[model samples]
Target: MSRAASPDVARNARPYLYGGEEAAIASALSAGQYNHGAVTEEFEQRVAAFLGVPDVVAVASGTAALHVGLLAAGVGPGHEVLVPSFTFCATVQAIVATGARPRFIEVNSGTGCVEPAEVLAALTPHTRAVLPVLYGGRAVDLTPARPTLDTRGVTVVEDAAQAFGSCQGERRVGATGVVTCFSFGPVKNLTCGLGGAIVPRTPLEADTCRRLRSLGIVESAARRAETTTYTVDGFGMRVQMSPLNAAVGLVQLDHFAEAETRRRALWRAYATALDGIDGVALVDADVDRTVPPMCAVRVLDGRRDRVFGELRNRGIGVGVHYPANHTQPAFSPWHRPLPVTERLGREIMTLPFHQHLTPRDAEHAAGELRRALVKADR
Candidate 1:
């Protein structure tokens, strides 16, 4: 392949903004409410309603959502959160922020989701929570682990950052007892520039998350606005979402169904084009109810890097969703050998997957990937 300039096909394109976003922003600006206000409340309500959860609290980032949600779920210092080491660093970061330690767990090879068997095996007296990620929006069959998690009194905090519109059976990701956290970053299915939300199962848990997101104030924002005096009742962080971001979130929510349709189409196109390609295999995911966040493939025969380089050379932007967190320097001390995670860490490669990608783009990327495999074999 020529190391030449080619028309760019973005690996992770900026989110497709809804037509109503600008108008929504204009309305918010006209109202002179840039702080976490009514618009933020509306966005939170919209999210809760969409997820079929009791309530939601929008926050600064997905990491913040994880931290506050865990705190609301009674995770704190001296507690251990069993998390998949194959996930983004944010998972462990949030666990640490809550003063809890993250005990790394291996992912199931088929789905890249945290293995329930591993969770059961890793439980300890200090195990306070089990943080399972919905890898690539694929469902982690939590039924098998629920009984054990309940018996041990461990909370299930779902990192559904990549699974905003995904579902397992008829239930949405956040609709269960799990305190699900979602990201609204630039690359997520729903974007608010940089924001996240926590869907709590109970109103009491929602109240706890709300207080923790704000500055632990006794008075709610509505109350603070009505009264002149307020008191700090508990510990909190300044993790509330700005009204501007909330406004964007509201508009995105309005058009999310349409956007999800495009994403699903692109995902299917990639799967169809690359299904039988040698040295490349698709990650297992339930696309029927999934929003198809990303189309990640595992490149085999020691050709992962070669394929990555070739794809880039052809102007097909690609990504490695993660390099195992357990091996990162920050978490190295806690590292234990995870055979499956280690194997997939070297093989997994994310192709250009976004709502903006066309069928032609998918075919071209797959063709280039096939060529790369042949060259690598030679």
Candidate 2:
């Protein structure tokens, strides 16, 4: 397939970076009260509505949302949380932040998600929660183990930072889990510049999350304005979402459907273009259920480093979704022999898949990748 007629896609420029949405954010800023107020509430309400959940509490970052959700779920010292080794460091950090031990489990090589069987095997009496990540925005079917967890009294907190509009079976990712955490960081599907949110199953859980976000305070200006006086009840962190970030988030939310459509199209383009390349294997994408947040492929036959180097030499920007978290120095003590995660971390390579890339750009990138693979083979 001669797919090389496109103009040069900028090696450094990502078509979907956030500067283009400044006007909407400026309009929200003009309303004053740039901290946490009506704008924040509106942002939260919109997120809650989008996820089909009852409540959403915005916080400073995705990590903070996970920490607060764990705390709100009553996870504390001596508790254990089952986490996937092949994920962003935030997953392990959240468990550690709650003063709980993270029982690292291996991921499924095919799906890049935590294996339910491995998670079940790791369950202990001290197990307080199981955090399954929606890696690359794919729907993770937890139905297979739900009954077992329920019987064992284990809570499921979904780490859905990469999956905002994803659906599993018939239920949205956030709606079915006891608590789900989302990130609005610069690179997430929804860019708030820097923020996160927690979706809880019930009103009480929602209220607790709200308190935890605001430094354990039971009341704030937003809450008091509805009543009379403000009150502080418990210790809290300054994890409240800023009006600035929320304003940006609201605009992002407004355009989310359109943005996701573009993203999905890009993913399909890459998948089609890269098919049958002997050295590269496209990561499994459940198009019907996932709105892929990143485009990744496995560089097979031990040529990962050579291909990665060649792409960089061609000025094509690539990324690694993560290294195996358990192998990192900070979390090494928790590391066990996770053969799949260790190997996948070495083989995985993330290609650019964002709202900005045109079909032609995708083709050109794939062409370059094909050339790189041929060179590596030689």
Candidate 3:
């Protein structure tokens, strides 16, 4: 059906871009206070509560949250952080921003999460920590790697950017990691217009993250207002979340549960509708355990480019989740032969699966994909 023929279709055709700035503006205006105020605190508290963590500090971006988390975890120059090559560049950028090196590792093509075995194989004495990305909201099973890290005395910092509400087995992604980071960027499941949060597993780590997030200052806005003077004791960055962003986040939190439910439903609808198609393999959804933040599929038989081009021509906004981070020019120094990561980088594609997409939209996308494949074959 032509989109112009139906208002319902037109409404459903709207792009599922993450975050709504209008809601943020309205909330900011209604609250009156604009800087780091009650809204920011409320957003942090709500995020922490939702993740079942004791503390959550909102920051300017997910990359900022990762930088603060790594700094708090004591990652610095001369140290190495084992990271998956099959992730967004921000993961490596965060490591570099902390003056640490990101040692690239391979990922499993089936799940897109880091291969714990490859991580253990790549470990070195200088490896202080490992940052496993939860790709496409599929939780990286860190249970097996716990022993490896313990043996090496390395911390496990989870990059749960794409898996904010995802669960592994029984526990949520952020609640168990030593220092977990979540991105609320424009495309993330939960967005604050452009923000992120860090959930520390320990009190000391949480305190350190808080300190680092605000310019090495010990006092928060909440604390500063209660006292007369503020003291700057250590080095920190200006990574604190603004009240304006927090206001949007607070509103988003109010609908988080419902949003997640809708996202999952969309994921299922896409998977069910697209399963039998050639040239694409949908990642397995452990619906009973995992809550996928994005719907990812692998384009097979080297047809990725043609498929992507066709989707774009049809106004279906698809995405390549990542290019192998290790292959990026800036990160080439850490690059080794990562065959799986390289292959997946070429094949992986993300479809629109957000709260805004109706089941029919997903089906339409799937139908278009099928047509694209047929055309490519011809």
Best by TM-score: 1
Q: Which lDDT tens digits does candidate 3 get at residues 256-312?
A: 777678878888888888989978999765655666776788999999999988888
Error of 3 at 300 (Å): 1.1
Off by over 4 Å in 3: 1-27, 30-32, 225-229
Q: Pairs clashing in candidate 1? A: none
Candidate ranking under lDDT, highest first, comes to 1, 2, 3
lDDT of 2 by residue, 91-206 (tens): 89999999999988888877788767888898999999999988999877777888999898788898999898888878777888578899988878888889999998788888
Clashing pairs in 2: 215-236, 215-237, 216-236
Give all candidates' CA lDDT scores: 0.86, 0.83, 0.81
Q: Give the TM-score of candidate 1.
A: 0.96
TM-score of 2: 0.93
Query: Given candidate 1, what's the lDDT at residue 346?
Result: 93
Name the weakest run of 10 consecutive residues (lDDT summed) in model 3. Answer: 4-13
lDDT for position 49 in model 2: 91
Candidate 3 pairs with clashing backbones = 216-236
Writing each residue's lDDT as its tens digit, candidate 1 over 1-378 gives: 224323446554557776888888889899887767899999988888898876888999899999998999999999999999999999999998888888999887777898778899999999999999999998676779889899999999999899999987898888866789999998898999889999887878888888898899868878888997998889999999988899989988988889778888888888898978977879977788888788888988778988788778767888998789999999876788888898899999988777666777787788888888887777
